[model samples]
Target: MNDFWQQCSTLLEQELPSQQYQTWIKPLSLLEFDIEASTLHIAAPNRFKLDWVKSQFSSRIADLARDFCCKPMVVHFVLDPKVARRANGATMAGSVDSASVQLAAAADLTAQITSLNSTTSETSIGQQKNSAAAGSGWSGSPLTNHESSGAPERSKLNPVLTFENFVTGKANQLARAAAIQVADNPAVSYNPLFLYGGVGLGKTHLIHAIGNQLRQQKVGARIRYIHAEQYVSDVVKAYQRKAFDEFKRYYHSLDLLLIDDIQFFSGKSRTQEEFFYAFEALVANKAQVIITSDTYPKEISGIDDRLISRFDSGLTVAVEPPELEMRVAILLRKAHSEGVDLSEDVAFFVAKHLRSNVRELEGALRKILAYAKFHGREITIELTKEALKDLLTVQNRQISVDNIQKTVADRYGIKIADMYSKKRPADIARARQIAMYLAKELTQKSLPEIGELFGGRDHTTVLHAVRKIADVRSKDALLNRELHVLEQTLKG
Candidate 1:
C-alpha cells in the first residue's frame, strides 16, 4: 500500500505544479487495503483535507490504485488526526532547547494577547515594546523544507523578495511597514494582514518579504503561500477524492499562510467553504494569515459575505500605484540590482510615461536594458524611447471613447450608432456598458467623459455601467473570456 501511494505521488508530481503536489498529495498515507472488499483506505489529517483530496485527486488515485491492486478498488479517505500530531511532535523534538523556547514564546504571545484585550490605555506602548522584544532575539534557520512523514514540508518564499530589495515609496510604504510588523511579531500583531491592489503592484513581493523575514526569525517555521486558484484546484481534487481531513490538517498546521489573488475565490463556494474552515483553524491556533487580492473586500462580488468579513477583520492595506518619483526610484534601484548603468534622465523618461504599476515599470526597464545590450548601444533617453517606441505608442495612443465604442460594438455584432443612441434594450445596453467599462479601463477617459460619449448619460450612470461590467466579468466566465478576447483584439 505504501509503495502504491509513493507511485501515485510520483505520477501526481508529474501532473500537478511542484508546490501543489507538495501541499496536497504528498501528505497522504496509505493505511489499509481490503482485497476482498476491494476497499483501499487512505489516511488524511482532518475532514477538510479528506474532502479536498476526494474531490480533487480521487479519480487519479482510483486509477492508480486499480493498476496497483490488479482490480477495481474502492478508495476511502479517512481522517487520521494522530498521524499529523505524531509527525508534528517528531519534527519539533529535534532539539529540547528549541521546543522549550517555542513553548515559552507561545506562552508569552498568549499573555500579550490577554493584556492587549484587557487594557486599552497602555496597549499602544506595550505593543510597541512587545513587538521590539519579539523581533530582538531572532536567530534561527532560513526557510528550508523538512521531511515530515516522508512528505517534504516547504515554503514558497522567493529568495529575491526580501525587505532589503523592496523599494519603499509613498505608494507601498504603509504596506511595507505593516508587513514588517507582521514578520516581526507574526500572529501577535495583525493576525491576518490583508493587502490588495492592482496587478504589478508590490503585493507579491511584500508577502514574500514577510515570509522570508519570519522564516529567518524562526527556524523550521511552517509557512505556506499559495495562489487562490491553486487552493481552489486543490479543494476540487480533495472533494473528488473525499480527502478533506488531510487538507485541513496540512493547511491548519501552518505558522503563516499567504494566499495571493484571493479575488479568484469568487464563485467557488466549495473552495470558500473549505478555506473558511482552514482559516478558522489557523487563526484559532494563533497562526498568521496574509492574503492579497486585486480589489478591496467589499468590491469583490460573488464571494461569501462571511469570507469577506474575515478579510475585512484583518488590517487591510492597499498598495497603490507609484508616483513619478517613486517609479524612477524603482527603475533605478532595479537597474542597480542588475548591475546595469541607468542615468537619472533615462529612468525619469521611462517612469514618466509608464505610469501604471511597479511591475510595468520594471518590465519596461528590463526591455530597455535588454535592447541596449543586444544592440551594443549606450543607455540614454533617446535610446530608451527608441527601444520602447512600440510600447510607448500603445500607451500614448489616445484610446478614445469613440474607438472603444466602435471596437466593442463591432466585436459584439452591434451597430456603432447604438453607442451614441438612447437604446435601452438588453443586448444594446449590455454592449454600451461594455464599451463604457472598456473605455474606463483602456483609455484615460474620466467617468464624465465616458458618460458624455455614451448617449450623454450622467457620470453616475457611466460609473454604474463600469462597475456592473467589472462585476459580471468576474462572475461570468464566458463573458470574462469574451472581454479578454475583446481587449486583446483592441490592443492588437
Candidate 2:
C-alpha cells in the first residue's frame, strides 16, 4: 500500500503544480488496498477533507490506481477517526501524537493569554473603584468583568503576522498606515477600519498584524481574530445549545475584534441580527473592530443596510495587487525569512512573470527553491524559468477579456455591467470604449468574441472603439495620460 501510494504521489507531483500536490495529495493516508477486488480505501482526517478529495481528485485517483494496478480499481475516500489515530500511532512510537501536540500548544497559548487577561482585569477593576470614589467617569475595559465570568481566551492569530514583516508599497501604503494607526490607538482612531481587496492582497496578514500588535502592547487586552464563516458557525452552535447570552457575552467582551471575509455574512439574517447587537454593544463601549472583505461594504449584498452603513462609518481602504517592484521586494523578504539567498535578478525574473497575487509569487518561489535544492544547482534566472514554465504559461493565458473588463471597470470607478449597458452617458461610454480598446490590445480574442463579451455589439463597433481611442490618444492629453496609466495598471 505504501509503495502504491508513493507511486501515485510521484505521478501527481509530475501532473499537478508543486503547491497543489503538497496541499491536497501528500496528506492522504492509504488505509486499505485490496488487490483481488481492485479497491483502494483512502482515509482523510475529517469530512471536509473527504468531500474535497471526492469532489476534486476522485476521478484522477481512479485513473492512477488503474494505471498502477494494471486493472480497473475503485477508490473510496472516507473520514474515519480510527484510521487517523492508527496513522498517528505509526508515526514513531514514544513520540507525541499529533492531536496531543495540538492540544498541548493550545493549552499553553490559553494559559499565557489567560494570565494577560487576568492582569488587565485586575487593573480595570482597580480603576473602576478609584473612579467610583472620586465621583468621576470611567471608561472600563470590556475584558474587566468578563474574566470573572469565565469566558474562554482563545486567539486564532498567527505568530508570523507582524508589522516588521509586512511589505508596503504605493499600492497599500495608505491601508498599512491606517492599520498602524488603529493598532497604536485602538478604539480611538479608525474605530472600525474596513479593508477590502482581491484575494491574497495581504488583508488577512494586515489584520493579524494588528491583533498581534495589540496583544504585545497590552498583556490583558482581550482579542479575537475569526473568519466570518467561523463566526456564523458559532452563531448557529449558540442557537443549538441555547447559549445566546454566553455568545453575546463572549463576543461583546473583546477589546479588539478582527473579522476576515465579512462577505460570507451575506444572506445570513439571524447571524446578522445577532452580530448587529454585538457590534452595537462593542462600539458603545469603545471597543475597536476591523473587517476585511473582497468587495466594498456598500457593494456587499444581502447584508442589512444598517450593518453596511456601520462598516462604511470607519476608514475603508483597498489593498491593490502589489506593483512589480514591490513584488520583487516581497519575494526577497520571504526568501530572507526562509534563510534562502535569492538574488535580485532571479527574484525579478520570478516576480515579473507571476503578476497574479502574492500567493502565486510565493508558490513559484517555493517551487524554484525545491528545484534548486533537489538538483544541487545555484539559484539563477535560467533555473526559475525552467521551474515556472507551466505556471507562466497559465498566467499568460489567464489575462482574458473578462479580466481586462473588470480591471478597467475597477480603475475607472464604473460598474462592470456598464460595459454591456446601453446607457450613453459620456463617462460610461468612454469607460466602455476604453475597455473595448483594452480587450483589442491585451487579449488574443477575435473581434466578434470581444464584441459578444460587450453586450453583443458588432465587430465593427469594437474596431471603431479601438480606432477612436487610438486617434484620440494622439491629441487629447488627459485621455492619453489616462490610457497610459490604465495600460500600465493592466499590464502589471
Candidate 3:
C-alpha cells in the first residue's frame, strides 16, 4: 500500500504543475494504508486541501489505484497531526522541519516525518506568518490523492477567487470588509458569517479567500469548506452505510466550516438534523462558520427553524448582482488571467450584452476568442458581434420551423424532401423531428407553419415531434452536440 501511495504521488507530481504540487501536494503525508480493507490513510496539512482533494481528485486516484495495483482503493484523510505522527511512526524519525525541507525533495522520507511532527509553536511561528502572507496573494493550488475511508467526497474551490480578484463595489463592500476582518482575526468579528447572493456573485470566492488567509496565518489551523449539497450527500451516504457517528465526528472536529449553497438543504429533513448538530458543535467551540446561500436565511423556505435561527445568529451579508462598471472590471480581470488583451470597447460590449451573470460574461468572451482564433480574425466589435450572435439570438429570439428543417437537413446530408417523404426510416424521422423543433425555436412561425413545412403535418403533430426530439436530444450526446452546432451556425 505504501509503494502504491508512492507511485500515486509520483503520478500526481507528473500530472500537476510544479507550483501547484508545491502548494498543495507538498504538505500531505501518507500516514497509513489498509490493504485488506482497501483504504489509504492520508494526513493533510489543513482542512481546505483535504476537502479540495476529496472533491476534485478522489475518483482519479481510485482509478489510478486500480490501474497500478489491481486493487480497489478508498481514501481516508486525517487532518489530525497527532494521528498522522502515530500512524507513520517509522517514517517520521529524523525528518527535518517543513520549512527546512527543499521544494524539489519535500516528498522525501525525511520531509514527511518533519511535516507530521511540526507544531504551531514559537519556532514555527515565522514560517506560519510567511505562509499567511503568501496565501493572501495566492490564487489556487492543484489537488492530490490521499487515502481515506468512505469519507465524503470533496469539491474544488477556485483558487483565483481570493481577496485580490474580488472587486469591492457598493453592494458587497460591507461584506468584503467584514470578511477581511474575519480572515485577519478569525472567531473575533463574526463567529458565524452568513453570506447570501444570487449565482455568480462573489460569495464563494470571499469565503475561500478567508480560508486561504487563515491557513496562511496558522498552518495547523483546521478549515473545512464544502458545498451544502455535499453535506446532504454525505448524510445520505452515512445513513445508507450506518456510519453516522463517523460523519458527525468528521464535521464536528473542524475549526472552521464554510458551506456553500446552503439553500440546497432547505427541504432535506434528515440532512438538516445532521447539519444542525455540526453547526452547533462548531459554533460552541468558537470556530468560524461561514455559509453562502442563494436566498437570505428568512427567505429560504422549508429549512428548519432552528437551523435558520442559527444561520441568522452572526452578521448577514449580501452580494448584489454586479453593476455595469463592475461587470467591465470583472471582464478585464478575467481577460488578464486568460492572457487576452481586451480593449475597453470590447470589454464594454461584452459586459453590456452578457449581463446575465459573471460566468456568462466569461463564457461569451471565451466563445468569441475561440471563434476569432478558429477563423483567423482580429478581435473587433464586428467579430465579437458575429461570434456571439448565436448565443445572443437564442437568449433573445425564437427559431422558426423552416429554419430548423433547413439546418437539420443540411447537417445530416439529407434533403428537405426526404424529411417529408413516406420513408418511416429511423434517420429520416429523426431529422424531420429535429427540423420541426428548430423551426419552433428559430422563427416566430406557428406550429401549423412548421407542420405544413414538413409534409403538411398538423400543429399537434409538430408538438409531438418537438417533444420527442427534445427527449431524444437530452439522452443523446451526439445529437445534442449536433443541435448546438446547428444553433451556432444559424445564429452566427
Candidate 4:
C-alpha cells in the first residue's frame, strides 16, 4: 500500500503542477488496503487536508490502486485526530516550512487563495499604545486557520485566501509583488497599496493575503478586512445606534485596514466621511491601509477630490486580465485542485474564448467539468466544444487584419493607408505594430499572411511587431490599457 501511494505520488508529480503536489500530495499516508475487497485507506494529517485530499486526489489515487492491484479499487481518506492534536507531528504544520524545494517556483505565479504560508518581516506598529481598541471591542488575538481571533469583532477574512495559492503570470506580476511587499513590511511599505482592476481580477485575494500576513507577523495588531458596502452599513448602524464614538475608536485604532471594492463608497456621503476620518487616523499613526476598486483611483467617480488625492498618494497597481499562458496555467491549477487532469488543448480552447477575467475563465472550466461528469464522458476538445458551444458562438466573430488595422488607425488618429504604406513616424509605426499584434492575438492568421496583408512586409516584421507590443504591454501601463481596451472593443 505504501509503495502504491508513492507510485501514485510520482505519477501525479508528472501530471499536476509541482506546487499542487507538494501542498496536497506529500502529506498523505497509506494506512491499509484490502486486496479482496479492493479498498484502500489513506490518512491525511488533519481534517482540512483530509477533505481536500479526498476531493482532489482520491480519484487519481484510486486509479493507481487499480493499476497496482490489477482491478478496480475504492480509495478512502480520513484524518487522524491524534495527528491534529500534535501540531508538530502533522504533515500540514510542516507543509510550507518543511518542503526542501525552494518556494520561488510557487511564488512567481500570480493568483488568488490561501497562501501556503507567509514570508514575514519587521513590524512598524507600536505595541498596542491605543488602549481604546480594547474598550471599543477591536482587540483580538492572532488568527488560526478556520478560526477567528476569538475577539468580539470578526475580520471576516477567508482563511484560504492567501498568496501561496495564487498562480501568477504577466498579467498581475506588479500587483502581486506590491502586495507581498506590503504583507512583509506592513505600514512601512505602500501605506495604502491601492489595487485597481476589473472585477474578479484577484484584487480581493491580494488584499486578504496582506491582512492574513499581517495577522501572522504583528501579534495583537488590530486588523480588519471589509467590503466598502459593509463599511457603509456599519456607518449607517452607528448613526442609528448613536455609537459614533465607539465606531470611531474601533476604526481609528486598527494596525492594518484592508478594504475591498472601494468603488462601492461612491455616492455614499456619510460612508465616505467616516472612511476618510478612519483613513486619515490610520495614516497619521503609521498603520497600513489597503484598498481595492474596479477602476483607477482618479477615475472612481462620485468620490471627493481630497480622498482621491490621498488614494493616489500611495502605490497603485492595476491587476489586468491574465494573459493566454497565465489563463491556461490557472485552468490547470484549478482542475488539479478538483482532482482532474485537464489537457492543454482543451485549456487553450476555453482560454481563447473566455479572455475577459479569471472568474469567467473559471466558469467555463466548471461548465466543462460538470458537463463531462454528468454525461460520464472523458474531458476532451470535443467535449469542451459541446459544453461551451454558446460561449463559442458569441466569440466566433472573425476579426481580420484589415479590421484590426482600421480599428487601430482610428483609435490612434492615423490613416488606414499608413498601415500598408512605409510610414516610419512614431505614432503611425506604433499603431501599425499594435494592429499587427492584435491581428495575431485575435485571429487565426499565420504570421506570413498577416505580414502580406500589410504591404507585403516580411514575416519577421510582423513577428517583431507582435513581440514589441507584447513586451511593452507588460511594462507600460498606458499602452497596456490601450491594448486592453482595443481587445475588448474588438471582442465585444
Candidate 5:
C-alpha cells in the first residue's frame, strides 16, 4: 500500500506544482487497495483538504492507480484524525509542531491559567499588597506575593517565540525593540507596550517573546500571557463562580501581564471593565503590561475610551508586512533552521510572490519543503515557482492596479468610479491617493503606468501620492491600518 501510494504521489509531483502536490496529494494515504473489487480507498488529513483533493485531483489519482494496477480503478477519500495527527506531527528542528498542535497546547495553557488564577489561596493577598508598595520597576528579580518557591511560574507562553530567534525587519524592528525594552526593564520602560498590525505580522509572537523574556529574567515573578478571548472567558467564569476577588487578586498581583488581541474585548462591557481595573491595579503597583491588537489603540472601536487611553499612554508600535529582502532573509533563515540550505534564488522567488505576511511565507515554504522532500528533488528557483504556482496566479490576478482601486474604494464606502474621478472631496481624494500608493506597492507597473491608470494623471502625481501616503502611514495609525487592510485585500 505504501509503495502504491508512493507511485501515485511521484506521478502527481511530476504533473503538479510543488505546493499543490504537497498540500493536496502528499497527505493522502492508501487506506485500502481492493484489487479484487477494483477500488482504492485513500485517506486525507481532513474533510476540507480531502474535499479539495476529491474535487481537483481525485480523477488524476484514480488514473494513476489504474495505470499502476493495469485496470480501471475507483478512488475513495476519507478523513482520518489519526492520519492527520501523524502528518501534522512533523516538527521543524526544535520548533513547535503544526498549527493544530499549537492550538491544542494553547487551549491547555488557557485552562491552566483559569484554574491557577481562581484557585490561589486567599492568604496570598497580603503578599501582593506588600509587594505593591515596594515599587514596580522590574529591576532585580522581585519575588511575587503568591510565589513562595524560588522557581518561575508557568507563564503559558510559547518558549519558541523568543526574541533571540525572532526575525527583525524595518516592519517589526520598532515593536521588537519596545518589547525588548519592556522585557528587560519590565514596568519602568513601557508600562504597556502596545503592538498592532494586520493578522500574522507577529503581534502575538512579540508579546509571547516579552513574557518569555521576563520569565527568564525574573524567575519569581508572577507572569501570565493570555489571549483577550481567554481573558473574557475567565471573567465570565469568575462571574458565574462568584470568584471575582480571586480573579482580581491574581491579575492585580502579576509582575508582568501579556495580553494578545486586545481588540477581542469589543462589546464585552464586563470584560473591559474588569480588565480596566486590572490595568489600573497592575500599573499603579508598577507591574509591567504588554498588549497586542489588529489595529491601533484608537482604532479598536467598541473598547472603552479609558482602556484605549491606557493602551496609548504607553508606547505603541506597528508591525508592517515584511519587505522583499526581509522576506527572503526570513525564508532562508527558516529553511536553515529546518536543515535545508535553500538558495537565495529560490528564496527570492518565493518572497517575491508572498507579500502579505510571514505566516503566508511560512506556508509556502512548508509546501515547497514537503514537495521537495516527498519527491527527493533539489530545491531551486524553478522548483519554488512550480511549488507556488497556484498562489502566484491568484496573487498576480488580485494585485492588479484595477483590483487595488476597487478594493480601496469599496473599503472606504466610495464608488469604484471615484478612484479615477477628478473629485477632490476629502474622503474620495484620500481613497484615490491610497489606490495610487497601492498600485505602486503591489504591482510592477511604472509610475507613468500607474498615473495613466488613475485618469491619465502625470507620473509625478502618482509619485507624490505614493510618497505622501508612505510618509503619513508611519505617523498616522488609522491610515496605516486602512492601508494594511487594503494591501491584505489586494493580495488575497
Candidate 6:
C-alpha cells in the first residue's frame, strides 16, 4: 500500500502543478485499502481540504486509483488528524530540513488529532514510515501540485467553532442538519447550501462548523473559507497590484468554498464578474460552495442577474431569530461561557425583552452582568428591568398600521388611497397587498385592524397576503428588495 501511494504520488506529481500537489495532495496518507470491496480509505489534514477534494476531484482520484491499483477504487477521504499522526511519528528535535519539518508538522497535527479522539490507535507501521520519511528530508511542497498552479496563501479557519459547539433549535435545526450532511459529504445532498438570515443569526457558524467537522474527519481536502467582503477586497487588491492571475489562482483551487456575508458582493460589478468566473470554476469541478448572507441571493441588490441565477441553483435555508426558548438557551450558554451565573427568570426576562437581535441580546446580558458586578449586587428582575429600561422604551414605541400603509404606498409609487380602494388591477392589487403585508410585519397591528385599514378586507385576506408576500420574498429578488426597502423606510 505504501509503495502504491508513493507511485500514485509520483503520478500526481506528473499530473498536477507542483504548488497544488504540494499544498493539497502531499499531506494525504492512505490509511486502508480493500481490494475486494474496491474501497480505499485516505486521511486528510483538515475538513476544508476533504470538502475540496470531494467536490473538485473525487472522480479523478477514483479514476487514478483504479488505474494505479488495477481495480475500481472507492476513495474515502477522512480528516482524521490521529491517522496522520499515527502515520507520521514524532519529530526529532533540532531538525531543520524542510522534509523533516513537514514530517514533524504532520506528526504534531496527527498527535493533536489523536488527542481530539482518544479511542483511536497510536502505534502503527505507517507511523514508522512517517518517522523515516521525516528523517530522510523528503518534504515536498504541496502547493505546486494543485490544478490551479497560481493559488496564493491558504485560508485560515477557526478550530474552536465546529458542528459540536453550534447550538441548534427550532429556528436553525434544518440549517444545522443540512450543513452537517453537506460537511459529511459535499455535493451529495445539497451541492450549494444557501443560508440566509438577519445578522448574527449563526449562518457563519453553521458553515464554519461544516468545515471544522470535515477537517476533524481527516479528509485530504482543499477547503476555502472566505467572506464575500474579503473576496471583494482581494479582487480590488488584485486589480490595484495587477495580480489578477494570483487572485484567480487562489480562488479556483478549492473543493469546498464557504463564503459569508454575500450581501457585500452585491454592489461591486467588477468583483461580481470575477466571482462569477471563480464560481463557475468551482462548480465545474463539482466542488461544494456554501454561502451565507443577511438576505437571499436573489434579494442582493446591485448584483448581476446571472450570478444571482447561479446562487439559486441549490437549497436555500433561512436562520430565523431564535425562538424564546432558544434565546433563553443562548443567554444561559453565554452566561456560562462568561463565568456568570443567572437565574432562569432573569435569563428569560432578558431574552424576551431583547428579541430584536442576537448581538443585542448578548450585549444586554453583558451590560447587566457588568452593572451587577460593579454595584456588588446580585442579579434580580428589578435590576434587569432597570438596566434595560432605555431599550424597553425604544421597543415600546408603537408603529401604526396607517403609518406602514403610507410608507409602503409611497415607496411603491402607489397612491395611499389605492391601499383602501377595491382595485383589481395588477399593480394596485399588488400594492394593496404589500401594504397589508407591511402592516402585519412591521407594526403592532392585529390582522383585523390591518384588514379594516385596507378597504374593509377580512383578517384572512391580510393573513393570506402576508403569507404570500413572505413566500414570494424567498424566491423573488426584486420583490424581496422592495419589501426590505419599504421596511427600512418604515423603520426610519
Q: Which ten residues in a row have the lowest lDDT in candidate 4?
A: 143-152
Candidate 4 per-residue C-alpha lDDT over 171-261 given as tens digits, one digit per residue, 9 for 90 to 100: 6877888888777656655778898888888998888887877677656667889888888888887788677777787778677888989
- Per-candidate Cα lDDT values, in order, are 0.72, 0.73, 0.66, 0.74, 0.73, 0.68
Estimated TM-score for each candidate: 0.55, 0.57, 0.51, 0.68, 0.65, 0.57
CA-RMSD of model 4: 14.7
Mark the regions of model 2 whose C-alpha exceeds 4 Å error after superposition. Answer: 1-153, 400-492
Instruction: Give the lDDT of residue 328 in candidate 5.
Output: 64
Q: List model 2 lDDT by residue over 256-367, tens digit each.
A: 8899999999999998998899888878767789999977677788999999989978878766666554676678777767887776446656765676568888888899
Which regions in candidate 5 have their CA more than 4 angstroms from the true location? 1-134, 137-154, 407-433, 444-452, 455-465, 488-492
RMSD of each: 29.6, 21.0, 27.3, 14.7, 18.1, 23.2
| Candidate 6 wrong stretches, greater than 4 Å | 1-152, 240-242, 398-492
Q: What lDDT is obtained when candidate 2 is compared to the true structure?
A: 0.73
Residue-level lDDT of model 3, residues 305-344, one tens digit each, is: 9988887788776665554445666666666667776654
Expressed as tens digits, the lDDT of each residue in 1-492 for candidate 6 is: 887788888887787533345545776788887888889888875444565556545666788789877878888989766634542222212111222333333334434433433323234333533543233212221334433433345676788777665655545666776676566546545657899878777888888888877665544566778888778777777777777777786677566789999888867999889888988887766667899888767667888999888888887877766654456666766776787666645665676556555778888898898888888877877888888888878865746678877777777689888888888898888888888877765554567767888889977688678768766865675676676567555655
Top lDDT prediction, candidate number: 4
What's model 5's lDDT at 394? Answer: 85
Candidates 3 and 6 compared by TM-score, better number: 6
Per-residue lDDT for 183-251 in model 1, tens only? 866766686899977788899999999988887777867788798888887787667767666666677
TM-score of 4: 0.68
Error of 3 at 88 (Å): 64
Worst 10 residues of 2 by lDDT: 87-96
Q: Is 2 or 4 the stronger prediction by TM-score? A: 4
lDDT of 6 at 133: 29
Which pairs clash in the backbone of model 2?
none
Alpha carbon deviation, residue 154, candidate 5 (Å): 4.6
